[model samples]
Target chain A: MIELNDYLILSGLLFTIGLVGVLRRKNLLMLFFATEVMLNAANIAFAATSHYYNDLSGQMFAFFIIAVAASEVAVGLGLLIVLYKRHGTLDLDNLASMKG
Target chain B: MYEQIAFYLFSVLIIGLFLVTVLTKNVLYSMTSLAAGMVLIAGIFFTLGADFLGVVQLIVYVGAIMALYAFAMMFFDVTKDVKENNTNGSLIFLLGGLTALMFVIIMSAPIMSENIQALYPPMAGVTNPQAVGMVLFTKYLVPFEVAAVMLLVAMIAGIILAGKKMDQSLTTEDDVIVEIDILEEDEK
Candidate 1:
């Protein structure tokens, strides 16, 4: 039998992978992708908990998270395009014009 | 028995595909893997009997979101490899490991408690979608409407931001080169 802990563990592992991507990647698009992975990880945890506990709240939270992620992507990708247009490169190191 | 096998299989596939999504240098490869991973995650939702959520995941994440990303990717040179400078590998490992450990401990803590009870348990005869609709309409109606408004704002913002230079072809823009040169000089 697959325990609830197993699903939680999987969620944790995926979250870690996403964190690594966020920390290590320099490409702005890849960073956004990493955030998406983290969001999905949280969704898994919430959905699994909802399933095991027979609660609708966790799934509802997951639904809201999805909605927020969609909006985030819309705004974020727009910002990315603008930034890319100005900078000509997506490298985080190169985009560091605000470094004091 | 079948659930166990399916769960294990989907778990492995989902994790592996996400790893590829995170670690791959090629954006195309990463995008493809992420989409596949998302589809499998919907499969996981289905396995958990969240039939409505599974379908939503399929339609939203795999269909709408990924398609938006693929469309946006057209503005960039997808053939070029993404270059990253990892100056401190140990710091990343240490941070990632610590966060992972913390997440695992906090998430699994509830599993040991064994006292959690469902607040809104599903009706015995109701389908997953029906139950979700009932709770959503009655309890979450306001938030759903708010989410719709937020999406509308985001759409307008995206359109305004990206529509600035819509007439200029990204690949064959002489002014873009001139602008980059000016910006580089400003930096120097």
Candidate 2:
């Protein structure tokens, strides 16, 4: 049987992969994608823990997370579109004009 | 036995697809792989017996959000190459790996000990959806409404941001035309 520990470990691995992606990637879109992956990792942990504890609260929390993620992606992608249109490139390094 | 196999399979698929999502240079490819990874995560939710959550995951993540990502990918001129210039790549990887290892060890420590136990036993008779709805509609009603409001605000904000970009582009085009006209008069 798959135990709670197994699920938690899996979530941790996924979250780590996302962290690596965020640190390594230079594309703004890919950064957003990595953030989404990290969010999903959190969701998986919440759902798994809820299952383990037989509490619906965790599931409810996951549901809220899903809602939040949806809104975040929508707004983020909108901003990304605006940024790309203005800058004509999505590379993170080139977007350092605001650096002081 | 079957659950274990399914869990491993889904996890592997998710992790692999996520790697593809982040590693690939093509925006469309990355979005597609991310969508696939999301579907696999929904599968994991199903394997964990959270049927409502699994379906919601499929619909919200794989269906709705990914469609938005695909649309955004198309909005950009993705012909230019995307490159990662991580100068201290080895150092970053080493640090990231160590951090992940530490996180895994800390998170799993409690579960490894025999003393850890669930506070409540799994509900036997109630269906997953019913149980979720019961709490969501009653105890979590305020948060639920707040989430709805948040979605509405996001929708309005997305529309405004995209629309503003369109206006800015149009104005910039006009400015470019006026600049060209002034240059032509100067030459004359």
Candidate 3:
């Protein structure tokens, strides 16, 4: 039997990978991808718990997370385009102009 | 038995693909692998009996979001390698490991305390999507409407930000400024 713990472990692993990517990757788009991975990890945990406990609330949360993610991409990608236009590079270090 | 096999297979594949998405330097490879990983996640959702969520994962993440990313990638020099300045490598690994361990411990707490009950259990004879629709319409209606409004706002903002007017920099090279310069020269 595939227990809830298995899904949770997998989710944790995925989330950790995402955190590392966020820490290490310099590209703005890649950073966004890493955040997507983290969000997906949370979704897995939520859906799994919802399944095991026979509840819909966890899935509801997952649904909201997806909607938020979509909104994030729309806004974030627009910002990225503007940034790329102003500055020719997508490197995070170069984009860190507000670091005073 | 089959479900277990499917779950394990999907887990391994999803993890590997996501690793490629995160670790790869090539933007095209990262984007493609991310899309594949998302589709595999939808498979996992199906095995977990979240039919609606599985479909949404397929459509929104794989279909819409990934496509948007790929389109955005075309705006930049995709062939150029992304340069990263990771100052402390060992620290990242140490912190990531500790975080993963802490998450594992926290997640296990739920399994240890099995008495936590479901708030809205799935009613018998109700399909997953049907049940979701019922709850969403009645209980989650306000939030759903809010999400719609948020998405609308995001769309408008994205259009405005990435619009054609971006070509004319107000501080430097604006067409209107050039026209004004031409008019001042004529007046002089």
Candidate 4:
């Protein structure tokens, strides 16, 4: 039988990988992808726990999370398009126009 | 035995695809990998008996969001090769590892100490989708309505932002004159 710890551990590892990607990647799009990975990691944790505890609230949270993620990507990609138009590049190094 | 094997397989596939999505320099490849990873996550949901969530994940993430990503990718002249210059790589790894270790320790602490009993054991005959729907509409009615509104607002915002003229330098007077000229030309 698969234990709850096993699922939690998997989630932790996935979240770690996403954090590394977020820290190391320079492209905004890649950052968003990493963020999605992290969100999925959380969703897995929630679902696993909900299953272990025999609760439906966790799945509901995951459902809402998916909805929020969809809206976020829509707005974020729109912003990315506008940013690329203004800056001509998506490289983080060149997008430091607001540097203090 | 089969459940354990399937769990491991889905986990491995998801992690590998996510790594490709994050580490690859090619944006299109990354998007493809992301979509694959999401589908694999839905597989994991199915293994865990969250059938409704698994199908919803397939529809929302792998279907709708990824389609939008593919459409957006076409608008940008993304470079085929992207060079990454990570200066503080070691420092970042050190901090990230420490944080992850902390998170794992904190999260697992409760499970390690306490014997948590499941309040609602998985009902073999109960339909997962119907149960989820019952709670969603009854207990979460307000939040559901709010989510619908939020999606609507996001749709409007995305269209407005992406459809705006790229040349922001054009004055309002110039824009009005150009619109007027186009209207007059249309009438002629």
Candidate 5:
């Protein structure tokens, strides 16, 4: 049967994939996408635990996390756009001299 | 039996998207696929019975974050991403090995013996959302407000950065002239 351990295992794999993207992709935008993968992995685990205990707290925490993630996207996208217009690209290797 | 089957199916879906998010060449496409993976995770949440989070995951993640990704992508001239697409397969294996090691380290920690670690049965009425809302609004209100405030700041910052582009680009006529001249000369 679909067990909690299975969900955790799946999330673990997904989280590792995100970590791989974050570690390997030199493109700033891809890094952002990877970060989203990681966030979703956390959400999955949160929901799973909440379901296991039949408690609302985990769900509530997930709710808050969702709200914050949305805001993070809004801001992160804006910064990315600015970087693109100014630098004409989104490679992380090229952005090291930023924030001056 | 059905639960086991569902677990395997969800696991494949999640893991497949996990790889896609890392391997796709196009950033926007990867982001969309990530959204798909998130919705599937939300389904997993539903399976777990966290209805509130499942719905919130849809509204906030797929709805909001994916849209923002699309918006950011629209601003870029993606053709300028000229580097050859390359990935280190050996590094991927290394990362995988490290993760497995870390997982083993975490899951094997000797907390109490299984007999001692087993908990009493949960209380009869502890499953509702109201109890959580009460705790959040009462005990965790401060951090909650801080998160909200952080969102507000992020929104303002995004708008400012996006808006500043017009002023800077328009005002920098001298910088554009030389670049325009070079482009025109090359076209001839």
Candidate 6:
């Protein structure tokens, strides 16, 4: 079994990769995937820490996070669909038209 | 020894698929990779002794939400979105450096160094899945109900909004095409 500290390190690395993806990727869908990566990284950390602490609350919180992620994807993708129909594309550069 | 080997294997799959999720130009493929990443994360949760969460993650994430994403992709007719891919440049390197600095700071945290043995002590033998279900259904019944309601609302909204696109795409294609042909004939 891997140590909890090692798990934390893994979580941290995953989150950073996710952050990089979110920052660098211009495609909204890719960014959404990146966000999922970050959320899962946090979820892993939460569950691991809870395991280390012997508390049920962490796992419970992770459940809540999972619920929220599900809801977000549902709504967010719905919006993305609308955006695609309007803009004809998903590039962030083109998304600027909505700003001004 | 077995644990280490398993950890390495899973880690390779986790990180490799994660990069694939980020790098793949195809949105559908990206979503698939994301689903795979979620499943592997659930496995991580299992290894961490969070059995309830691990199963929930798999069910909710890989099963439900990934399907939802795929369906939305189909509904949207995302033919244009795939064409305008942006190449990520220095952002990855910069974010890597920043996160490294963060890791250094996090690793050096006094609280971490203080050794919270009081935290998760190893209960390597017990199965607590039933215990969590009991708590979720009994103690947290109200919140659970509310969450179910929230999920219903979100689900309904997603259906309604996505439904609009299908309706629009068909109607606009039919109506607009007829209107354009008539306008062109009238002009001539």
RMSD of 2: 5.0
* Model 3: lDDT of residue A10: 91
RMSD of 1: 7.0
> Which candidate wins on DockQ?
3
DockQ of each: 0.70, 0.62, 0.75, 0.65, 0.46, 0.55
Q: Flag regions of model 4 displaced more than 4 Å.
A: B109-125, B166-188
lDDT of 2 by residue, B1-188 (tens): 99989998999999999989877888778888999999989888888778999999999998999888878878787766677777887776777778878877886676567555554344579888887787789888999999999999999999988777355577789999999999999999
Interface RMSD, per-candidate values to 1 decimal: 1.0, 2.0, 1.0, 1.8, 3.3, 3.0
Question: TM-scores for chain A, candidates in order?
Answer: 0.97, 0.95, 0.96, 0.96, 0.92, 0.94
- For residues B37-153, write the lDDT of model 3, one tens digit per residue: 999999999999999999999999999999889888887988977777779988987898788788878866866877778888888999999999988888899999999999999
Ranking by lDDT: 3, 1, 4, 2, 6, 5
Candidate 5 chain B: 10-residue stretch with minimal lDDT: B111-120
Tell me the TM-score of model 6.
0.80
Candidate 1 local lDDT, B103-155, one digit each (tens): 77876776678878788888889999999999999888999999999999999
- Give candidate 2 misplaced runs (Cα > 4 Å): B102-124, B165-188
Cα lDDT of model 4 by residue, B1-188, tens digit: 99899999998888899889877888888888999999999998998889999999999999999999888887787657777888998898888778988988887787788776654444467799988887889888999999999999999999988889755655887999999999999999
Model 4 scores a TM of 0.87
Q: Candidate 3: how many backbone clashes? A: 0
Give all TM-scores, in the order shown.
0.90, 0.85, 0.89, 0.87, 0.78, 0.80
> Candidate 4 chain A, which ten residues in sequence have the lowest lDDT sum?
A88-97
Chain A, model 1: TM: 0.97
In CAPRI terms, where does candidate 4 land?
medium
Pull out the clashing pairs in model 2: none
User: Can you give the lDDT of residue A94 in candidate 5?
Assistant: 76
Question: Which candidate, 1 or 5, has the higher DockQ?
Answer: 1
lDDT of 1 at B19: 88
Clashing pairs in 6: A52-B119, A52-B120, A53-B119, A53-B120, A54-B120
List, residue by residue over A59-90, the lDDT tens digit for candidate 5. Answer: 55676777777777777788888788788877
